[model samples]
Each structure stands twice: as C-alpha cells, then as structure tokens.
Target: MQLTGMFVHPLKSTRGIAFERAFAGKLGLLHDREWLLVTPDGDQITARSHPQLVRVRVELLPGGILLHYEGKPPIFAMTTVFTRPHRAQVWKDVFQAWHGDQRLDAWFAAILGQECRLLWLGAQSGRALKGGGEKMSFADGYPFLLVNQASLDDLNSQLAQPVTLRHFRPNLVVNGDYPWMEDEWQVIRIGEVEFDVMKPCARCVLTTVNPDSGEKNPDGEPLRTLVRTRRLEEGVCFGINLKARNEGMLQLGAPLEILEQRYSF
Candidate 1:
C-alpha cells in the first residue's frame, strides 16, 4: 500500500496541519503536539471536554503559531522559549514544560472561558512513552497514530452519514486494499522511518465531534457503531498507535512496507 495522507497536530485538540512530507523523530512528526492547553493544575484539555478547541484554526509559524476562530481576533503565540516553566500533566504523566505568554494564555482563557494555560513540550521533555523507553511530545499516547483509507471506507459504508478522517485524528493514513489490514501489522516502514505498530488505539467520544464546526454528534454515532463492530477489552478500537524505531523523512505517496504481521485477534 501507499502512504496517501500525512498530518501534524502542533497543539492538542486544535486543527491538524496537512503536509506532503514531515520529519519523523522520537515524537513521530516534528512540532507535532509540541504545545498544549492545560489547566492550572497541569491537566491537559481536549475537544472531548471542550469541543470549542477544534474550532481553533492553527497555522505553524516560522517560530510560533497563528490561531484563528470565529467572532474573535486572531492571536499569535510565540514559542521562542517559555520563560515561566510549569509542571504539565497528560493523563498520569507529568513533565516540566514552559508556560506561554499571558496574552496567549488569556486568549485561550477568553475563548474557552476558563483559566487555562498553554504549555510547551520542547526538547527538554522528560515523560516516557506509555510502554516505556524513549520520550515523546504531548501526543495522547504513542508518538504516531495510523489509519487505513480502506478501513475508513468500510466504516463509512456502514454509517448513515460518513464521518471524516479528521475526527479520528490520525498522523499517517495509508492506502490499502483490504479493510482493517493494519490490525495485523507489527512493523511498517514509510520511506526511511520504521515504526512499531504498538497497539490498537482506543477510540473516544472526540470522534463524534464535527471537525469543521467543533459540534458533537447529537445521536452518538461513530462511537456507537464502532462499539458494535470494533469494541475491544480496552475500548472501541479503530486505528493503531505507533512508535518510530528510526527517524527519517516521511513523504506522502511513499510505499508503506510491512515487515511483520501478527493480529491481536
């Protein structure tokens, strides 16, 4: 199969930046989830709790980022270097992170209507990957998430109104012939980078949100359907989480070569 799509999420829960190619490192993609929104307690925030986050359009700058949303003035948050560092928490993992400017923090506070701060997970990150060994950005669990287009197509065929790939928020989307072929892939290589298909990614309520509007599915759809078909002991699983074994440049349309296959089922 071929790699058809590539994306980077600079900030957690915000819009993803589509790219033709990206540098892959320990964190999967460079600048991916390097910054994040967190409470004063360092707890991470997401569209699952605050759906408005998806409404924020993010454009990566030469240094910082440009954030745009409806009915609000655009704001630019600089990442030159965080002066005030804070303990940032994602799930149960906590690490030292730099807090953004009050203006940037206030921007998010005003938009979310809560006292939230933006934290940067730069090269100084200390949090270990879920299964141990190596560090990562503020990405949910693993360094990368992969989905097959054919699998999404299969899912769309079963839905009344198909959901977009944005809802699933995958980092790498591959073009494959059969549905759910990724379930059996243990290792895959795109260009020069090799990734271990760590485990099945547990789907969440965030998938029900409309990526364009930040509105949730009123009927509790995709999640409900996935529960009926893709449910696992962990949760409703759709995509696969990945950890890069080697760093390199990943380009779209590159052939996805599987080195090993072992089904969890």
Candidate 2:
C-alpha cells in the first residue's frame, strides 16, 4: 500500500487544497482546519448546514489565506499576529481561539449571506483528544481522517452516479490490496509518521453536498447508499479516523507500512 494523496483545509468546512507533500504535526496536517467559521454566539457552522460554504476555495498563503468565490475578487486574510482570545465551539469542545479581524468577517458574511465570525486555532491549541493526551485542531474529531481508494472504488461500483473523495473530506488517501482493507489496521506508518487507527468515521449529510456546486444531492446518493451497505451501530460509515503517534513529513507514493493489525481479515 502507498500514500496516493494528501490534502489540507486551511479553513474548516471550505474546499481543501491537495498537496504533493505535507508536514504532519502532532495535531494534524500543518494548517489543516486552523481556521473555523462560527456564529457570532460561537456556534459552529459547517457545510452540513450551510452547504454553499463548500463553494469557497481557500488557498493557504505564507502569511495567511486567500479566499476565492465566483463573481467576487479574491479576499486575502493575513494571519492575526496578536488578538484577544475568543471563545468558540466545535461539537462539545469549547476553547479559546483568535478572531480574524473585522474585515475578514465582512467578506465572509457577504459571500455566505450570513453573519459569521472567523476564528483561528492559534499557535498553541488547548483542546485535547477525548480519551487521549494529544492536542488537536478544529477538525471534526480526530487529527487525521484516511480513506482507501479501493474502498471508494468499491462504493462507486455500487452507485448509479459515483462520488469523489472530495465528498468524504479525508486528509490522506491510500491505495492498498483490496476494498475496506484499512478496517483491520490498528497502526500504520505513512512516510515517516505513524498513526493509530482511531475509529470508523461515520457518514453524515455533509457527504450529500457537491463540492463543486455546493448543492445537496436531490437523490441523497453516497450517503444513502452507505446507509444501505456500510451502516453500523454508529450510523453509516465510510472512512477511518486516525491520530498520528509522531510528527514528520508525508509525501505522495510513500509506502504504507501496517505496523499492527487488530482485527482478523
């Protein structure tokens, strides 16, 4: 098995940027989900609710980020070097994050047609994993979410219209021997980083949103299909959540070594 793709979402819930190589931090891929969108009251807003957010393309820049949307000039938001710590929420985790200035707020509000604030996770994060000691950023739950290409291919073969990895929003994509082969993996090393296979990632309505158009599928595909085929006690499942045991650089085509297998194949 080998690493086939890597991606990072500088801003949570927006389009992700594919990379040939990425720095894996203890928290997550560098710059992955470092920024988040929230209601003025600190409630998180994601593509699951605001589907149009998927239309916003975020390009990470050295100092900050560039936001691109149709019919509008690209908006550049520089990283806030200094700011008062603002409180925000992601699921049940509430912690202090930095506000990205008023200019950025206005631009995002105009694009999304809703009042919202952008929060930065800051250089040091305070939210620790639920049962583990490692820190994490604004990702849904785990630091990394990995998907198998063969698994997606298998899912595609069952669908009338195929879905892409964009819908699943994985941080890493690997190709291995067969479909769902990653399910049995307990610990795996990609490039120089080793990750613990955390749990099966549950699928949600977000998977029904088209990354390109930001439109919810009228037919409710992949998600519906998953419910029929991959449903578990935890709801429909698709990918596996992972947490890195160590930090290093991950590159495309790096051999994936399964260090431990906890389940019988």
TM-score of 1: 0.97
lDDT of 1 by residue, 1-265 (tens): 8989988999899999999989999877888898899999889988899999998888988888888988989988887756687988888888888885888888899889899899888656767887777897899889999999999999999999999889899999998879998888999888888999888999989999999898999988899899999987767999899999889988898888989887544
Model 2 C-alpha lDDT per residue in residues 1-265, reported as the tens digit of each score = 8999999998998999999999998888999998899999888889998898899999888888889989888988777652767888999998888885887888889977899998888889868777977788999999999999999999999999999999999999999789988888999999889999988999899999999999999999988889999987666899899998888999999999999997765
For every model shown, the clashing-pair count is 0, 0
Following a full C-alpha superposition, what root-mean-square deviation does model 1 have from the true structure? Answer: 1.5
Write down the lDDT of every candidate, Cα atoms only.
0.88, 0.89
Q: Which number leads on lDDT?
A: 2
lDDT of 2: 0.89
Off by over 4 Å in 1: 263-265
